[model samples]
Target: MTEDFYCDEVLSDKIQVRKVLETDNVLAYYHTKPFWPVHVVAIPKKHIPSLITLEESDNELLLELLRVIKKVATMVTEENGACRVITNLGDYQDSKHLHWHIVSGEPLKQLFNERLQ
Candidate 1:
């Protein structure tokens, strides 16, 4: 992600979403292959590769994004009683973009706990 970013060429086919809130440096939207009943992706508009490349200047934006995660979690949990906030990296993550997968549901919680162990 440290290198140049190519949006139209990079995500032209991966994304099934057209609805988004794009900033000068990031993109936020809902996920298509939802792990839970409610799933969305909060990804940096900039290409930063993964979370490992995070710098000090990215702190404020990350914090603000987290706050949004909390709000969404509350809403999702209110309806489902629990939720998951997942940020993947390296080989484990399917996507190269640094993003948060916000998901919630009883079944999802079970899946999350199973993966933890």
Candidate 2:
């Protein structure tokens, strides 16, 4: 991640990220930028540096994250009739925390990449 990119670079607070839901190891919230018709971010509150840095202790968190992904997926599909999901890491990662970018409908990759770049 670049020095200019970090957790704070994006939405800073729980309030900044629209109220969605929070599980034990993950915080699922609406993305400030709706890349797709249905967009949300399932992020771990833990200050994890990146995906590769995730530890064995993160297994539970990982599992919960996946579960949140499923829930979000269902909700988006049923409510918005859109289907898409995204998560970046390493050079593509801007935030220090582990966050799953869940999206649906429309092509958002190009714009997202461009803006982040």
Candidate 3:
């Protein structure tokens, strides 16, 4: 995978995702590969690397991203009664792109299998 999966694959449309919400600057979608029973991902339309990498100039973008996250979280909570919004950085981050996960429910055992082919 590339350093910025969101920019390289997701935003590029190389990887198709089920969209939950979308706006001029943000997008919320069902995870391409879900880890939890109810997992949704939200990302900025523009590349921002990671949360810590955000600059003061990105204040508006950050606010927009948060709005999308909040909306997605609310929907998840309404359906599941509970939900969490999370973001990863540094080593914990598999994708270097700035993205947030609004998820609910327990983790799944086997979401997708590896194909030897």
Top lDDT: which candidate number? 3
RMSD of each: 5.7, 5.1, 4.2
Tell me the whole-model lDDT of each prediction, alpha carbons only: 0.66, 0.72, 0.90
Give the clash count for each candidate: 3, 0, 0
Clash pairs, model 3 backbone:
none
Q: Give a tens-digit lDDT track for model 3, residues 8-58.
A: 998999988999999999999999888999999999999988999999999
Which is the better candidate, 1 or 3, if ranked by TM-score? 3
Q: How well does candidate 2 score on lDDT at residue 62? A: 80
Candidate 3 runs further than 4 Å off? 110-117
Question: Which rank order by lDDT, best down to worst?
Answer: 3, 2, 1
List model 1 lDDT by residue over 4-80, tens digit each: 22244335544357433555555556665566767867766666567888888889777766766676667667887
lDDT preference between candidates 1 and 3, better one:
3
* Per-prediction TM-score: 0.67, 0.74, 0.90
Candidate 1 lDDT for residue 80? 78
TM-score of 2: 0.74
